[model samples]
Target: MSADSMRVRRSFSRVWPVALLAGPGLAWAQVSPPAGEAAAPAAESSASAGSADEPVASSPSAPYLRTQIGMVLETRPTYLGSPNRETKLRPVLGLQYGRFRLSSSRASLVESSGGGGQLSGASVDLSPRGPWSLNAALRIDHGRGAGDDPLLAGLPEVRQTVRGRVSARYAITPSWSAGASLSTDLLGRKGGTLGALDVGWSTMLTPAWRWTLGGGLGLADATYMRSYHGISPEVAAATSRTAYVPGAGMHGVGVSTGLTWNVSPAWRLGATGAFGRLTGPAVDSPLTQARNNWSVSVGAVWVKDWRD
Candidate 1:
């Protein structure tokens, strides 16, 4: 095979597992139709009062204030360990001001700045060219603590870490996009580097409904692998656990699918489901019991268009 073909094959191999996790959800969420076909009613709603034979006028775009709130129920392994599951209720929020956006779901923010450029909680991007754009950012990983779970009673705490990342994305088609990111813990809190690649697509089923699907793979450097998954002799002796050092490798993968329903021009509702699995060192860690995690959520959004 040609070099490009080989690269594509390798990429698919890495992403296949994630796709499998997210694939079935597509069928479950496919209760809609073509995106273009879904917008007719919304356009008609904005028209001025007129006879059927008169041309319907279109409204101009305006600045708006938007916010969302929701509750999520999720099952996850206790402290990244313990086969036992913990059910938790989480509150999620999203807000938008002009070109600025903030999402409690990811604890992040994004805004347009400096003449059409964009800035996000972790990165920045200049004007996008054609179907491609590049961005860079710094991220924080609030490391784990033994006190976070009973299963981690004797394990050492993993402190907060700061990482820098660069990413590039391309529009594969009007409805699909793909991207990859590279990141490294620049502050040495768990000194390591990681990479990921993902693809996503969305479609509108009706004037009120839309859904999206996405999946990705994760890889880590030896330092990152060891920091989060390895047990040193001293730590093993102190904690009474086996000492096992993990090497660099693919750590995990996951997928997600979600749907949104526009209740009106000012109100919307959403639901999402996601699944993930741990592998490599993360799976081999003495602290690890269950390698799989899943979550589901539902929420609503409210918006106020500003005439100013």
Candidate 2:
């Protein structure tokens, strides 16, 4: 390996833990109020442009643009260890321009919503069909510091990373979709690569209420597995933990369900719950204490539509 590769590996072993966006487990729905009617925007409502599950609505004379702002609350593992839990309040922002979209928050690709990940940085989308979309994104993966937990005090600090991802989504019907994604280390921060496949279904229960369901499979490469789960002998001796190496393969499976209510044309309310389990090396790693991962999020969004 090159010197840079060695350095990256060392840094990988020393890095700390951070949060990931709970993708594949959430869904979204968009509904426009009856024609010739308008609704007041609520400060805490959820309304945004159409996602993958629906076609992008448009006007004959103007490009469609919408902006969404909101906040989400969730509890997730502090690191990969699962022994520590962190509850965080994450701000949400999403924008749409014609066939282009941008957002910091994530939704499953199957729902044509930007699938889950961290709630920072930005992602861009391109759709060539009413039912298919492609996306590229840059995001921050917060690193972990050994000192944050006694069990990791002597380990190296994992620094924050800026990584990139490319993904594609397809809407099979107005209420169902499927997609895939690939993410890789862009900043060379020892961040590894990840791949995933997802499917989702959404429907309207009433004129104002909608619900969605989704599931996914996750895969990791050897580099990602070793960087995040591998243990070195020297360090194992120091920490008195067995040195182990993990191989790359299928690593996780997840499911998500969500509900949304349109209070008005401009305001919306939504909530989601997701459950996931680690498999293969991720669960077998010495650093891991549990195999189950779960989260819940609730938020409201207010949308502003612009004509150009």
Candidate 3:
């Protein structure tokens, strides 16, 4: 086998395990598809497997370290579905090598990666070039605690739980795509199953500027609903709130939009915002302070990379 053939084979070998953990691929998890969408991995794998004996050679592009450093300012609700909001200032830093990228969902090196309900955390893209993108991520779900709010004083103190997620996104077009992702409580603090369905569009305003808009539908099973939105009988009695139990259904809908400017090869700037509204049983719960939530983010990015 030639060097080029060997490289593809090696890539396939590394990617299959991720595919298994994720049940194959293709589905929108949250985030932007890297500027240069990966080459079609399935097609390349198939073509290469059939011609393993063919002699071929092509110089590999010199590897380069791509890094982004900056700061992001974000504003959103104090809690999910909260009527009040707060603003946060966070540092932005990210790096990518070959097919693997390490970055926050907002420390974008490509373009905007927000949907209606994006969570901030660390994530790694474990996908090859193509229509499919997959990510393994970890985040903190700061569950509500007693006294955290006057209304939640008597309710159980939901200890913060670390969480993990596996998601996939498929690009249906250069400007359209759809995806689904599943998240689970890694520490098992009763943060039941949560999911999101993503669909979005992007277009260039100029050679160096782009616009993106995307929608995400949120879903939660009984456990997640009960923990985050429900008022149990015992808790309701103590707190004098109405007792309610919720089942699985479409819990919310959200829309996110962004304006990104590629000021130069090493400098980028962007602004993004999202609006979300709770639906289904979650909307009917008495504990719900409000059915609507929103957030906005702005950032400046400086990148260190060498290549076209």
Task: Put down candidate 2 lDDT per residue, 1-308, tens digits, no spaces.
Answer: 56654664455334311112322111111110100000101000111111212232112223344557776665555544456666666655665443344454333111223322221234445555366766665555554567655656566665566656676767777666776767676777765777767676767799888776666677777766766666778878897887877878776766666677778877777776666667777787787776775656676777666543
CA lDDT scores, all candidates in order: 0.48, 0.52, 0.54
Question: TM-score for all predictions?
Answer: 0.67, 0.72, 0.72
Predicted candidate 1, C-alpha RMSD: 17.3
The collision pairs in model 1 are 33-205, 122-137
Best-first order by lDDT: 3, 2, 1
Where is model 3 poorest over a 10-residue stretch in terms of lDDT? 37-46
Give me the candidate number with maximum lDDT: 3
Report the Cα RMSD per candidate: 17.3, 14.2, 11.1
Poorly placed runs, candidate 2 (over 4 Å): 1-64, 106-120, 147-151
